[model samples]
Target: MNEQLEFVVRAAAIGTGATAVMDLWGLFLKRTLAIPPLDYAWVGRWIGHFPRGRFAHANIAQAPRIRGETPVGWVAHYTIGIVFAALLMAVWGLDWARDPTLLPALVVGMSTVVAPFFIMQPAFGAGIAASKTHNPSTARLRGLITHLSFGVGLYAAALFSAHLFPI
Candidate 1:
């Protein structure tokens, strides 16, 4: 494969793997601790409002439901994961994907917390880093844990990707 194609394949594989790992972690939390996973439908609803010139919501739950929001949110979620994987490649280069290191993956994974904390949370009316949530500290911690899992996932996935899509 051409270098560009190889890059794209690796990015998509790594990102998808990382995101799946994150989701599995979320599932573990829910099953073991009774912690609930994030409702991606909200993400879909939030994005659905964009076409209507709506950006931020006082409470996304109260926002009008969008058709197919569940699927939309899921697609967006995975796509975001893919984008982040691409970011990992962009920052560390394709060589990282080939070598599959931990630090860089962890760094990028953990850093992804900024998206929900600053952008997604605020837009969802959850406030910065979930500051406005019912329990801000708990929310923050959960987010941190989730992102850390993603980081770990990035590393694991990169390793798998290296094997699956060898350079």
Candidate 2:
């Protein structure tokens, strides 16, 4: 395989594996922690409403419960993983996929929290940088921890895939 195509393959593999890990994590969190599953479909619906500005800057946390759905949010969540994988490939090349590094990936994932803090949360009415809650600092810290965990997930997935399906 050509270098470029190989890179794409590696990136796709990493992205897929990382997304799977995240999905499993969500399920585990729901089941073990008793955190209600966030209906990703509802998140998607909210995304659909973006064009109309119906959900624009709407406080999602305060929104009345509607089966606890959010398809757009789920889509966004997975898409972010895909995008992050692509970025990792772009910056580090296929070798990174084969021999994933936890630190760099963790840094990248943790840094990504800024987006949800500044953009998504506020748009969904959570408040700027998680300001809506009684303890905004705790919320922000949780988000950072979650994203860092995602980074670890990404690295673990890549390593597992590389071993299971050697390139």
Most lDDT-accurate candidate: 1
Candidate 1: list runs displaced more than 4 Å.
none
lDDT of 2 by residue, 38-156 (tens): 45655665576655657654655445444434645665767777788888767777777777788767776777788778877777777888798678997787677667767777788
Give the range of the ten consecutive residues with the poorest summed lDDT in model 2.
Answer: 60-69
Q: What range of 10 consecutive residues in model 1 has the weakest lDDT sum? A: 158-167
lDDT of 2: 0.70
- Model 1 Cα lDDT, one tens digit per residue, 1-167: 99899889988999999999999999999999999999999999999999999999999999999999999999999999999999999999999999988999989999999999999999999999898999999999999999999999999999998888765
> Which runs in model 2 stand beyond 4 Å of their true positions?
53-55, 61-73, 164-167
